[model samples]
Target: MSPRTGVRLVTIFSAVVLAFFLFGDWLARRDAPEPLAWYETYRESLWQPIQDRSLTLLQADQALGRGHLWMISADGEPALVSRYNLESDDRLWQAQAVIGLGAEEMESLVEAQAWEPGIRDQPVSPAVGEALGDRQILRMSMIPVEPLELNRIEGTFGSPDVRMPVSEGEAWVYPRAGAVVAVGEEEAFSIMFGLRDES
Candidate 1:
């Protein structure tokens, strides 16, 4: 074969191999399931709990599925909280729910040996589970695996009701919706849902 012909054949073979790999990559990506978006998860899993005054652990489980429950003191108040690692497109986002317990429920949980300091894997006693089942969820928070685009926050929730300057960024509060979004220069870093005192 002529040198020029051999060179042309080699170039054609390389181009074909490159195109085959590119097409395979595209196919694999297209077939893979896309991870849930933060906004969608908020609307679906968190919105109802925040809106209803009577949401409970049982109801939350029905909405968000069973998660890892822990005994905690939130804002100096004894509370039970559950955390779930939510799968997202980029990474696992964290969802937390804080459940407020009454005096009686707290006593029951204490007696049931539910509170283990610094340990989250302790098996929940029947009494502890019963006590937590009916308690109200005071707040819910979603921490994205990656920072959220600033425009996405504004687009979903509209402008903030209050904006406070912080060391890293600004905190945008939407009291009516019971939401707080901590925004950095380019993106939002955190989102919380619960009632906040205006003052």
Candidate 2:
């Protein structure tokens, strides 16, 4: 074949190959199942009751089988925090809860256990449990089983009510939902609920 004809033939072959691959990719994407939404997954999980302040520190411990506990001040108020791990489908998921403690509760905790008030994760003493178990959970945060991309969140929920720069990520807060999504450079890593109300 002539050089010109050979060049044209090569270009046509390349174009056909590119078109074939593109079409295949499109078809594959079209046939793929839609991924579960982050909110839906969260709501269906055992952590749902925590969002409505229905779960107490001790109840959560019983349900999640006891996690690491910490005594810390949240917004200038004494609070009890716990972290739990859930193993499912060979993957590990983590959740955290912050329970607001009253001054009386803090006094009780201090008197009952050897713990000094500070931000540290320590073993939960039976005395501490008895003191704060019934305290209402103020916030719940979780690391999802699957990574959630930042764009997907914005696309689904629109602009957040509050967007602020946080350590290692940006916090996207939705006041009406009382939720905050911590988005890193690529994807969202953590989500928290019960931060605020619609009003």
Candidate 3:
């Protein structure tokens, strides 16, 4: 190629490269992650004064102290509350002061135990879904119970069925998992996520 043509080609390439990087930096700076950015939005928007009052007044599961339920977290990292606050409907979330269950809840859990059933090819109905969860497989230490008989386990309902002794422990609420089925001698909570207090 001629010297003139090569110089023209090189000049065009350099201009294009320069334009690309310049735009890229502008985009990144505009979208930078800012911690207080979210907080500032909440104050300026619908949540306004309420959010401001909350930041100063509300802390830790209701009472003010070290165990505050809502805070920036230990390592300056975002925590559950911090993340939740970013949502537009954050005001709707009822601020819960309750952490672990009370004495009564503990007492109910005392007689009852969680069972870990083996994973099956499909999820049996909590009643018949034998391969459900730990709450279902292990009979409560206090009560004598038998696991349901079944095989295949299924979808996202990964948590197994749980059983509590007939009429005991504030009714086994498998809050996080799946729906609960009323079996012969057991109260079934679906999966193990919703009301799953167990890890």
Where's the lowest-lDDT run of ten residues in candidate 1?
117-126
lDDT of 3 by residue, 70-118 (tens): 2222243221121111122121222212122335533443334221233
- Give one digit per residue, the lDDT tens place, for model 1 in 7-93: 999999999999999999999878554433666665645665565566677777777677777666554445567877877656667
Better of 1 and 3 by TM-score: 1
> What lDDT, from 0 to 1, does candidate 1 have?
0.72
lDDT of 2: 0.70
Q: Considering summed lDDT, which 10 consecutive residues are worst modelled in model 2?
A: 33-42
Give each model a TM-score: 0.63, 0.60, 0.21
In the predicted model 2, the residue pairs found to clash are none
lDDT of 2 by residue, 55-78 (tens): 777777776777777666555545
User: Which order, best to worst by TM-score?
Assistant: 1, 2, 3
The better candidate by TM-score, 2 or 3, is 2
Pairs of residues clashing in candidate 1: none
Q: In order, what lDDT does every prediction score?
A: 0.72, 0.70, 0.29
